[model samples]
Target chain A: MLKILVIGATSLIAQETIRHFAADGAEFFLVGLSADKLKMIQDDLLVRGAKQVSTYELDLTRLDKHQELVDTAMETLGVIDAVLVAHGTLTDQKAAEQNVDITLRELNINFLSAVSLLTILANIFEEQKRGVIAVISSVAGDRGRGSNYVYGTAMGAKSIFLQGLRNRLAKSNVTVLTVKPGFVDTPMTAHLKKNPLYSDPRRVGKAIYDAMKSERDILYVPFFWMFIMMIIRNIPERIFKKLSL
Target chain B: MKRYESWTRQPKVNHQTIVPLHWRDELPDLSQFDKLVLPFGLGRSYGDSCLNEHGILLDVTGLNQFIAFDEETGILRCEGGVSIEEILKMIVPRGWFVPVTAGTKYVSVGGAIANDVHGKNHHTAGTFGCHIPQFELWRSDRGRVICSPTENKELYEATIGGLGLTGVILWADIQLKRIPTPFIDMECIKFRTIDEFFDLSEDSHERYHYTVSWVDCLAQEPQLGRGLFTRGNFYDPPLGAKKEPRALPMIPMPIDLPSYAVNPLTVKLFNELYYNKQLRKKIGGVIHYNPFFYPLDAINDWYKVYGKAGFLQYQFVIPYKETREPIKEIFRRIAKSGQGSPLVVFKTFGDIKSPGMLSFPRPGVTLALDFAFRGEKTLKLLDELDRIVFENGGALYPAKDARMSGASFRASYPRWEEFADYMDPKFSSSFWRRVTSS
Candidate 1:
């Protein structure tokens, strides 16, 4: 059975991805912010067929607590077969743009905090020589748009970091995967208007599970997002800057 | 603006705001919101019951997480937003099954309870609410009320089939049926006349746990009520018998086929082919539960076959009066109109009483048909059928109703006034507003 460690275990996408693994009788060490939410997910995973589940509560934004979480997971699982960094906040781009504190806090949670955990997990997986490190990035990272540049900036940084991590971990056989999901109808996007472009979280979750199992370096969930992002990325900067996206 | 439509995709309404409840503990402070809010699940209700027009919709799907399950007793406690599909996936491997399941598995437990949904096995098992021993209802006024048969009995009865107006069902405890395997032993018998259909149904009711029929509504007088009668029970295999579950790959129908493509001529041909597809007069086999219960579900978004204008599901149950004349007259009108319903389900609900005050099922014969929305033409036909049903002391299922008169609703559910007393003042729905106000 695979021993997996999940950060942001309460996040909808993470919970769905873990459900797929749990059905295979995987053992899990989950870390999230809310103890109540964590406990609920722990029970859910157990019922889904997880052999064992243990949870720790700590806000991911607290970069200082990163090491303790990893140490606790290592102690619980002995050797982690996979680690999923699946937690992040969707900040209000308008508020983020107006306030430096808000912008910095958003960056801290979405970029710095994830980087902190991934950096530590990368070392442990390197020493172990066989494991997978998967992180949930966003398609928004592919290009900065006027509508959501603040959130895009943080995800863009995380995406670049994962690219380098994947390169270094490739030699050690510690597969690093970067999941770029398009508009998913999760709680984070509850306020946003949903359209045909918005994919269900379960679909995105299944894609993440499949990508992690296959050890793919990069994945654009729904596959169509790959082309969508490609078109957005190729647009001329002058033309892109003039149009509202 | 994002407009939410029911499964039929008709009468789309825009909720003022959609608040997603992700965790059970993280329920929003409903008191803060002045406007009436209704908890919405998978939006499988065929019509307006699931819609709130301009009111808030508390999207409970995110709160879909299992709380507890007793393997020995086959009792499961899970968040109300959990789908039957999810429940089956979790419990089927453990030799358990939902006591009652509708034609589709996409419906949330909350929706099932609110609608008091019944199924093919309803003759034996009753409504889905019958299996729900207890659940937590979160109201704007009363924070959390645990409703059951003994405690808060009125609220419990009112909440079931209360049309999501009573309150939000947070989590529910369901008593699951213990099955030998995930397969069902099914038999299909063809009947040429309404009398034969009734005879077959009456004969099978005592033997089969699940019973239903598919009628070709477009057939002429001789074969007017001609259809196939199917009956089944949980597959009980020989000792040490090995079972391999199989499910048909879901074929997604196009988002919208042209309205003209699904007219009477095409529907008639399709119905004819479907009826004759089974060459043998009788066939029996062990089949997986998925296809057995949800034949239409095998085709994802099967409603799209009705076309871009969308369709309306008209399901009504008329009390048995020792004759099948009411049903025949109704079928005669539909056949005469040449409306050509591509799908029609006919079943007889048994004496198993439901716990809900406003539950649709009773000791009656129920017929459900889908009509493509074609302006006033479809409405006129249904209105005529409603007269027959209402005169016969039948009730239109609120879950499947898009347009039933206020008088028809009140006449059908005599307990609606009593049920109104238990409804949360801050909870309302489009269907409720339309039927009650009129």
Candidate 2:
């Protein structure tokens, strides 16, 4: 059986991803911040005919707990066949700028924490030479405007980091997949807009699962996003900065 | 368990199934079940019509088998998943073609009926559902059922454009129209104003079987509705010249380009060039059916060009009497928005009855346009257009729509409840969940 570790397991996307792989009889060790949420997800997975299900309550921002979380997961499950890093916080840019502490917290939660966890997982996969890493980034990183540039900067950095990881792990037979979703209708952006090409979490989960199975290097969730963002990304900076977009 | 959040992208409210069972070819033996949703072909539908989110989504592509063909009568029977493109490849060379075709031929027969798709020939031949004589539907409550206009009339009507809420379609028998030749005698006409364009469309409708116009959305004021109208009908091939058969080929876009590629300026420039390039007021040419019907098919994975943020396709139809007013208002609003994206199309639909109770068409004009998601502004503009459609007594095509309100839906499709009554509760989807719950 293919063993999988899903970080931020309670997320809409993570839950769906877990359920997708679980239905395929893949073993899973789910990690999330809420014990209640993890239990709910675990129960749902078991009912769906998952091979095995385990859960760990994790505060991803706590870098000190990163190694322990991975250790616990590996001990509970067998060797990890895949690692899905689906947890990230979307801090309001204005709020982050207002407070220095908030800025650091946002940076750590969105980028540094993910880097710390993925680093350990990547190293383990590199040694095993038989695993896949899937990261969920955002299209907001393509080009940051005044509205959400801080969050976009964090995502941009994460994307670059994942790219380098993919290149470094190439020879080791470990595949790294980057997923850039535009606007997703999750609790993260529920307040923003309703169905604004906001991909359903289930769709994102399936796309990621399919990408993992196909070993695709990168996938834009809701395929159309790839083109929509292409049109946006091609605009010249001089012209782009002027628009209220 | 909801596997991939992405799959839940386009579900109905309250009926959204968190987990979707992904099956490739073989359909699960549904003999034991009481209700199931059949989602075959492409998921281009606007509503939860085909999706039974909570139950099973029987993929019928694997059952695709071309059964019979009448060389003389031009009648054919094929499995549900057999797309129009597949049919064109087999029949076009023999001078036979489908009675009607939608903008995209990638849709399966099952989808074609589920939506009661109408094409450029709708004015002349009616919708695709009208040409279909018989079909086999597998229902959970009732086993294998054969239906047609004369046989199981209610079930047949319910199944046609019924959004597959009735059952899984196994195969269908349809009447195909025979043409003198595979080539079309086409003409292109340019109109500087919407009024002039409608006049040309009215004139062409009397003379030609196929009529459509591509509007330049970027045009302002005096040129707001400037467009190129193309009309055609099959014609006999010249004597002694062998007909050059054109095959429909699949095109796929391999890579995702960066966002920010298509903006107002770029699209404006492109539309200007495209509109201007067709300098000839009228020209006769023999073009492939694929390009004529499914232009987007020429470029595979064309959606990827939209970048990481997917675009939304908004298509609505107004009754013939109120067509000009609503269309003019919609165009005026679009031009004023100044956020240009290519692909604004307009066409006139002929007398056609909706197969399903809530099916979205009437004898009138239809307009389809694509817009990038721009948060509140886009929604506001769409809301304005929705009001226009509602006021004009026109409904939005649910297949190509993603963001329509319940109130608007109620206004657009007055017979929604009649169709809703037949919805198998177990058969729920994200699209249905959103609409119902909200």
Q: Which candidate wins on lDDT? A: 1
lDDT of 2 at B88: 81
Summarize candidate 2's per-residue lDDT along A131-153 as a digit string, tens digits. Answer: 88998888888788788878888
The digit string of per-residue lDDT tens for model 1 on B108-223 reads: 99999999999999888999999999999999889999999999999999999888999999999999999988877888888888888988988998899999888889887898
Ten consecutive residues with minimal summed lDDT in candidate 2 chain B? B248-257
Off by over 4 Å in 1: A241-245, B1-3, B245-260
True contacts kept of 1: 0.57
lDDT tens digits, residue span B1-438, model 2: 112212113334332222121221234445554544445455556445545555555555434445566677777877786678767866776678999888777778888988888888777877889888999876656756888888877778777777666776778988999888776667777888888887887788878998888888878778978888888888666787676635333111111223356677777777777777657776556666656767766656565555655566788888766446677888899988876477777888887675656666687788887776566888898889888888888888767766787677776767667767655433445455556566
TM-score of each: 0.94, 0.59
Candidate 1 lDDT score at position A115: 87
Task: Give the per-residue Cα lDDT of candidate 2 at A73.
Answer: 87
* Candidate achieving the largest TM-score: 1
Q: Positional deviation of B310 in candidate 1, in angstroms?
A: 2.9
